[model samples]
Structure formats: C-alpha cells, structure tokens
Target: MPRKPRTSNISRSDYYDITFYLQHYACFHCRKAFKQSFDNQRTQRLCPQCRQPMTNMGTDFKAPAQKEVAQWRKVQSLAQAGIKFFPQWPDGRPGERPDTLAEIPAFLKQVHPPSEGEQMLERRSQEPQRPQTPREGKLSLQGFAPHQTFRLSGKMLITGDGVQVFHNEGWVNAEVSGHGNNPKQPSHLRTFKLVGNKLYYAETVPLDGTLRLRWPAT
Candidate 1:
C-alpha cells in the first residue's frame, strides 16, 4: 500500500484565519477555511464565471511573495480575493485549482468552532436560518426594465475593481448570489455565490447571512 502524502502546516496570516482552525485557516478546496490543517492533501474551490470548481495541487503549493500573494490578498473594501485559485484547471471537486490566498480576519470571524469560546454549534442551534429579508435596498439599473427576465445562463463574467453587472439586458452596478445553475427556482431567488474583482464573502450559508457574507473593498 502507498503511504499518504504528508500534510504540511500552513503558516497563516491574521486576515485569512477561520474558526475551523483554532488558529483559523481556510481549506484550499472549499474556499471555506479550517482550523485543522489537512495533511498535504488535495482540495477544490468553486469559480463564479464558469460555474465550475477548481482544485489545489498540494505538491506544488508554496507560500508566495508579498507582491505575488497580493493578488490573493483581501481588499478591505471590494471583498475580492487578492490571490488566485489553485489546481490551475477544472478536474471538478477535491482536486487541483487556483489559490484563494487573502481575506480579512473579520470575514472568517463567524466560522470558529463552538466550545463556549467559539460557539460554532451553539450558534447554529440558537438561530435557524431564513432567506434574505427584503430590506429597502436600492437597485440602480442602466437598461434593466422592471420585471424583465435576464439569464446569466450559468455564465457571468465580472472584471475590474468597481462593480459592473451585465445582465441579459445591459450593464449596471450590482452583485450576484445563488448556488449556481439550477433552472428550478426563479432566477431572482436562485441564490448565487457573488463575483467581483475585489470580492469577498462573509458567510457560507447559501440563503442568508448565516455565513454572514460580504465583499467590502478597501
């Protein structure tokens, strides 16, 4: 039998730590950080554009330079990853992908385990989740006609620092949310994982802020 690859320790920065790691760190695969580090194993991450996931090749993974790591770094304001994802391509789940390198410590603040100090399970038991509440949010559209049906077709592309949305109708300043291409739900209610150049997420739960999501660009 072959021996499993050695799981290496990931020296963490303050920004990317999560409760999963007592020290707090995200899994290269899930983009969801962990407290416990996996012994040099592979993992996966979801990409917003193609609606496909990427992976991390543990063998070649290494700490990058400050400038290089800057790409994966979390912008304080826009909430996007400064670094890239691992695996380089799409082998689907639990495999090679790009590096989701940077994040703010606040982003993963809610992910800690429950032990009286962290409150992972305790929080879950306390609060049941519901869908997004309709706050008095504003929608500034460039060419979006009210009640129009525009499909991203499971393929939405966003670039640049400022927010720019291109719906089937036209472009505007807005973000996305959902679980990717499921034709069942109404497009508006489908719940997409957002995309932006300086994007960052506050939580994991698809519907509400249970995973308290955000991408504030600094």
Candidate 2:
C-alpha cells in the first residue's frame, strides 16, 4: 500500500466545520425558556411543556424570570410582533431595547413600522360594521391544493401539503408539520407532527371569524 499523508499536514479548513451554539427558544404562554443548540439562528423550536411553537430569542437574549408576569408580557408582545432579541437590530444598529414597559411602545415604533396587514386591520376596525353577506360568513380551505401556500392571520404561512410552516418571515422555518382539520372537530385546523402514526407536538388553530386565512397571489 502507498504511504498516506500525515494527519498534521491537514489544515483545519480541510474539515467540515459545523459549529453549534446555544440559543434561547421561549414560550410566552408558558413563561418558560429552553436552550437549544443549532449552527444558525433561524431554527424554530417548540415548547417542551405546551408543545406549542416557541420563538427564537437569539443567542444574546436574556429571559426574564418566570415570576415576572408583566415583563414576560412585554417580551411576548415584542416576540409576537416579529422582534427577536438579537445583539443587534435588523438594520445593524446595536440593540437598545426598552427596559421598562412604558418605553416599549416608543422603541417599537422606532424599530418596526406597522405592516400593511396591520394597517388594513386598523382601518377595518375604524370602519362601521356592516351586515355580513352569505359569502362573508366564515373563511374556508375547501378548494386548497397541495404545495399551495396560505397566510394565517398575516403572521404565519402554511403550505396545503402540510410539510412546512413559516412564522412571521418566510425564511424562518417552523419545523412542525402536518396541517389539517382534527378528524373529530372539523371546525379547527391543526399543525402537528406525526410520530409513529400518532399525533405529536400539536397546536390547534380555531377557525374563528377573527382569524383570516387567504392564499396570496403568486
């Protein structure tokens, strides 16, 4: 056999570099946080206790104590508004998030402007309620097909194929799969994981009139 090259001759770059760092995934509803390791920050995780989707608070996030209900509420508001507690803002500015609840409104205004969907909702709220026609009763996914994507309440997106879901931004993948109606209750749609042919990591979304699910034009 031919002599092999010495291991010392190999450079560090020659090997595949997979560096994992611990990031915080928080469940605002549960008021708990968990640390998970991933090579990047875009990974979505679920709450172990509630099995509901959790928000990725990034590496620099320092979670408030569980007993701090008011602070947790503030954090929850920020997270739901698509704000991540990264070391820097999306615009590359150093993070200077509000420490007090009173300052949060102004800080959020400076950072995140009202999205189009939000503005529409606000305008609709200001408008007087009109009588509902037959077509405006309840939203339905009756004719939806596989691989087609639909937006949920302007915040989450789900494919009709039920294989993938994205929360807030499309690039951030929410790993839970399986989107369909609960067999026993057809009034609600559910996103879940199927493990060993049984339901796991499930979250139910009620098909109430308050939530709007629409297929966006491609």
Candidate 3:
C-alpha cells in the first residue's frame, strides 16, 4: 500500500506573528468563550480554565451590532430598488454569497429583528447626500529663500559675515576674518533649523555685539 503524503512543513519566514486579541473561540465540550493564538502548532487546544478542546470561531466571529444593522439595511435598500441576486459561486459556503441582493430581508432578519433593518434602510435611502468641501491648501516653502537679514520689530540687522552682500554689479561675501573688535571686525556664522513654523538657531548671539556690514546697493 502507498504511504500517505507527508504533511507540508512551513518555513520560519512563511509563518507570521498572529495576534488574536479580539478574536475568540469556544470550548468544544463546555462552549465557553476564550481568546486564542495560532502562532504555534498545537496537538489540542485545551482551555486554561476548563481544559477542554477549543474550536476556532473564525475571523468574522463578532462584529459591532450597529455596523451589522447598517450593512443589512443597505442590502435591503438595494433589493427594494429592483436589484436581483446573481448565482452563487460553485464552491461558496453557506451565509456567504457572491451577490446578496436576493438574500435581503431573510439575511437581514437573521442578524436583526423583523423590521429594524428594513426601517433603517428606508430612512437612510431617503436622506439627502451631503456634498464634501475641498480641503484648504497647505503653504509649501519649496521656493522660499532663507532670510539674509535678521529683522526684529522694524529694526533690520545684518545676520553675520559670510552672508551675500549686494555689490556694485553682483553679490560678494562679507569679510569674516576677525576674532574680537580688531582690524577686520568680529564675525561668526549662525546656523538654524526650521521646526514647524519657526526657525530655531542652535546657539545664541554672542554678548559682544558684532559689526554689521553696510548693506550694498540693490
């Protein structure tokens, strides 16, 4: 006699982490609900409290009561609007239909009462659809140039040396070769990062006021 084919072994990469926080299962014997994880292979799922084998309730085991009602109402509305259900798939399971227009009132009644789904669907279908407004455009600084001068209140002060100074016909780098108040004058470069809507500099301006290079002609 031919031996049965060996069960396929899964690779580590093929097995993904399964988190079943919201999903639940019921014990086969006691029918008590319990949360379960399918991460590791188990010969039997014995409940911690009952020690009974548990059966999977599947992914769609539970849903919000409101959402279920809303969905069924939508289906009933479509059916009432002259829609007909299409043929089901060849291998489809029960309660799972390819096209559900024909299953309206019955399918809906299973989830809700006699007329709740129908009433909600009728009320929703008659309400006027609101038009959505376009969102406001955000200001992008793609072409924004860095501020060459630091302006406070109304007084404008030169940033520092090494800044572009307007010259006779073109721009030239300002003299920045001195330590203190000597021949070339005190000069230092300041760096800043833009956070949200403001530019924040790393270091504060020195207490010793540095010389402000005269602004050249435009």
Candidate 4:
C-alpha cells in the first residue's frame, strides 16, 4: 500500500494561529454580536449565547470591549422596536442591518464621564487665541478680517496694485483684464472676502456652452 501523506507541524501551527483572530458576527434572532472561529462559525450558524442561527456580518470589524458591550446591551434593552431615533440612522437597504455598529465608540465617549485629566485637557483646548500670521498675507473685505481668505469668481475688480492671490501653497501674482464688451463678462476680484479658513474650488465642464461657478456672498 502507498504511504499516507503526513501533515507538517509548521503549516498546522500557522493555520491555527491565523484562524484564531476574532471575527465579528451578529444573530438577528437574538439581536446579539459575537466572535468565533471561521470553521466553527461556518458549520454552526447557531450563536453560543442565543443558540440561534446568526447572520454573518463579516470579519473586517473589531469587537467592542467588554465595558462598551455591556453599555450597548443596556441601550439595546431600552430601545423600542420600529421607533425612529431623533436623528434616524442610515441603514443602507432592507435586509442589510444598520452600519451604526461603528457609532458605538462615539456613543460611549459622549455618555461616559471622562477622567479629571481628560476634562482639563478638553477645557484648555477650547480656549481661543490670537491669529499667529501677519495681516499682509490675508485678503481684506467688508465683513472679514485682513488675514482671511475668500474665493473670487465672476466679474470682480482688484483695486490694490501688486495684489497677490494665494494658490497652490505659494502666492502667485494676478493680473485682471476685461472681456472687451462681451455680453458675458469674466469674473473680477475687487476685494478679498474670507468665508472660512479653508475653501474648495472645483471646476465643472458641462456639455452646454454656458459655464458658471458660484460662491456665497456672505
């Protein structure tokens, strides 16, 4: 008879270690979450806690800590079925459970009391401070500071000579010229208006002839 093939210890050890990682799964019947091995989980769909068939939520998620799990269990106990929350959660589609499982961390942070050190740090971070940069770099406007930046689109005229606009990490010298009696005139920059510290500028290419981009006046 032919000799039977032998299993290598190294391959068996690697397989055991790799398969030991926790996989996140949920049981719709019991409304519970659990961590289990792939082989056992495949064969036994029944939850150890509930002894009911579970819906595989996949292996990409981290299991919540014991404290968080206990706290969430309390919340689940109080939650009413079919009642929408103050802010209704976005649960992609029917049959696919809510992705709100990720929100547990934020919920925990909000409801749980922080240590004295954490409270002190949070308070200190909230205090306001003066602007560190000089006023020369910012654009001055009617309702904004000289250090603020605002976007310019449509016909605008910049009165100040040697006026530099911030672009691509460094300041670039800008020269404005008129559209020469055209019905649709180009945008002008009369004064710098800063809406917020950070702004996004995106250009859209539409099939129609007309081109338009708009920014808030306030």
* Clashes within 3 Å, all models in order: 62, 0, 0, 9
Pick by lDDT: which candidate is best?
2
Query: Can you write out model 4's per-residue Cα lDDT over 1-218, one digit (the tens) per residue?
Result: 99989966653223433666544555544556776665642365678877886544434433344456553444343232321122112642222223455654454455456889998998989988755532333222232232222224322333222234444444334333223342223233332333477433322121111212222222
Query: Candidate 4 — what's its lDDT?
Result: 0.41
Q: Is candidate 1 or candidate 4 better by TM-score?
A: 4
Cα deviation in Å at residue 36, candidate 4?
0.9
- Checking candidate 4 for backbone clashes, the offending pairs are 154-187, 154-188, 155-187, 155-188, 156-187, 156-188, 156-189, 157-189, 157-190
Which has the higher lDDT value, candidate number 2 or candidate number 3?
Answer: 2
Residue-wise lDDT of candidate 1 within 87-139, one digit each (tens)? 32455232323334344443344332236745666677689775453222222
Clashes of 4: 9
Q: State the C-alpha lDDT per candidate.
A: 0.32, 0.56, 0.41, 0.41
- For residues 1-218, what per-residue lDDT tens digits would candidate 2 score against the true structure? 98998666432211111234566788987998888766344445678999888877766678899999888888877776677655443664426767877777877877877899987998999999874422211233332343333334343333232322323333111222334443222343455556797865465554433443333222
TM-score of each: 0.15, 0.40, 0.21, 0.21
Task: State the local distance difference test value for candidate 2.
Answer: 0.56
**Per-residue lDDT of candidate 3, residues 1-218 (tens digit):** 99999985752212321442333454434535565566357456677677876544443333123335444444335334433232224643224422344566565555455577877898898999753532221211121123123322233333343333323444333433233443223334343445798865533332122323233322
What candidate 4 gets wrong by more than 4 Å, as runs, is 1-18, 62-218
